[model samples]
Target: MQAKEAAEKLGITQRMLRHYENEGLIEIDRSENGYRRYSESDLRRAGRIRDFIATGFSTREIKSMSACLSDEGAGPCEGGVIKMQEKLEHIERLQADLDARKQAVLDRIEELKQGLAAEPLEL
Candidate 1:
């Protein structure tokens, strides 16, 4: 498969596939004309990589997870655990900040509604 087909099958942009190649997460074979030829194994690896990225794992993290993924989700990759924990902590902090902003917006909306109710003009 070529870059376009691989990208379409994986539901990602070609640029992202190039980035993954540049980051050493996946590799592609070059044809005689230098076009990228993705193998079946490459596609499978790319799918796993995409899944990890969607779950908030960084490229570096995905690179380190090859062992864990190959092991069928068995334990023993301490680094993978540590990286996941860090991502989880970051997500928690982000959720807290978003929650605060949502509450502030709701409060402002309610204040505006009350002000409008108090100053109703004569029909």
Candidate 2:
């Protein structure tokens, strides 16, 4: 497959595919005429990269994860695991903060309602 065809299949722009190649995420073999040749493995890798990107992983992180996942008998790379754990912790903190904010907003609305009910109008 060609770069354009692969990118279309992956639902990404050609430039994004090239950018991933440039970032060492995926590679393409070159023909004698210097045209890029993509194999089935490359398409599978592109799908993995696209999925990771959609999940908020940066290109560099995706590249690292892919390399780790490719290792044989590595018994599961700990780096990606640690990174995901950290992200999960961060998300938990953000959720706690959001819940607090929501409570504050509810309290403020109740206070406003009470004040409005207590006001007397002469007109």
Find the candidate with the highest lDDT and give its number. 1
Give candidate 1's whole-model lDDT.
0.84
Task: Residues 29-102, candidate 2: write the lDDT tens digits.
Answer: 98889988888878777777787788667887776677543423134565767766776787789899999999
Please write out the lDDT profile of model 1 over residues 9-94, one tens digit for every residue.
Answer: 99999999899999988777999999999887788778878888999888887887776544354456657778778889999999
User: Could you tally the backbone clashes for each prediction?
Assistant: 0, 0
Off by over 4 Å in 1: 60-78, 120-123
Model 1 TM-score, 2 decimals: 0.74
TM-score of each: 0.74, 0.67
**Local error of candidate 2 at 88, Å?**
2.1
Clashing pairs in 1: none
Q: Which prediction has the highest TM-score against the true structure?
A: 1
**For each candidate, what is the lDDT?**
0.84, 0.79
The TM-score obtained by model 2 is: 0.67
